[model samples]
Target: MQAVAIMKQARISPQKARLVADQVRDLPVGRALEILRFSNKKAAQLIKNVLESAIANAEHNEGADIDE
Candidate 1:
């Protein structure tokens, strides 16, 4: 699930939030995090957190390591 933190940080309208979330959704964790990291938007930090969570979930639940 996308984190609510994205909304809080970006101060973005609901439509924009949905668009941003949709853009990143289903993206590989590392690539998603990189996209967020270089972003100028405030929502980037929140997006990074969500991506990190997704990465952690994938690592623990699926025995996949994003570092590799």
Candidate 2:
């Protein structure tokens, strides 16, 4: 199952957000969070929040194990 969370009208421009997203594409969640935590760009923080929310949705709504 897949859980997706999207943030619209972000303070950051689309171009900048896309750049951050591209960097984490195909990366594992743990690694992606690490990269976002250390990233110099502000967009990283926003993306990280959305990612966390998606994870929560997957766990709570989809009843998926975090270890998976």
Candidate 3:
């Protein structure tokens, strides 16, 4: 099962966030988080937060044992 998270009315511009997203695209959650954690961009933090929420939702709603 797949999980999703949405952040409405975020302060950052979509164009800026998309730049961060493009870099993290197709990466494993662990790897993505690593990149996000060390990234100096504000959008990286925003995307990281949403990704964490999605992972939590998958565990709670779908009972998927996402190990970390």
Worst 10 residues of 2 by lDDT: 1-10
lDDT of 2 by residue, 1-68 (tens): 57889898789889999999999978888899999999989999999999999899999998988777
Off by over 4 Å in 3: none
Give the winner by lDDT: 3
Give RMSD to native, each candidate.
Answer: 4.6, 1.0, 1.2
In model 2, the Cα lDDT at residue 15 comes to: 94
Judged by lDDT against the true structure, how good is candidate 2? 0.91
The positional error of residue 21 in candidate 2, measured at the CA in angstroms, is: 0.3
Tell me the number of clashing residue pairs for each predicted model: 0, 0, 0
Best candidate according to TM-score: 3
lDDT per residue for candidate 1 within 1-68, as digits (tens), equals 33222124455566755665676778766677777788776556666776677667767777775666
Pitting candidate 1 against candidate 3, the one with the higher TM-score is 3
In order, candidate lDDTs are: 0.63, 0.91, 0.93
TM-score of each: 0.58, 0.92, 0.93
Order of all candidates by TM-score, from best down to worst?
3, 2, 1
Model 1: CA > 4 A from native: 1-13
lDDT of candidate 3 at residue 14, scale 0 to 100: 90
lDDT of 3 by residue, 8-67 (tens): 999999999999999998888889999999999999999999999999999999898888
lDDT ranking from best candidate downward: 3, 2, 1
Model 1 scores what on Cα lDDT? Answer: 0.63
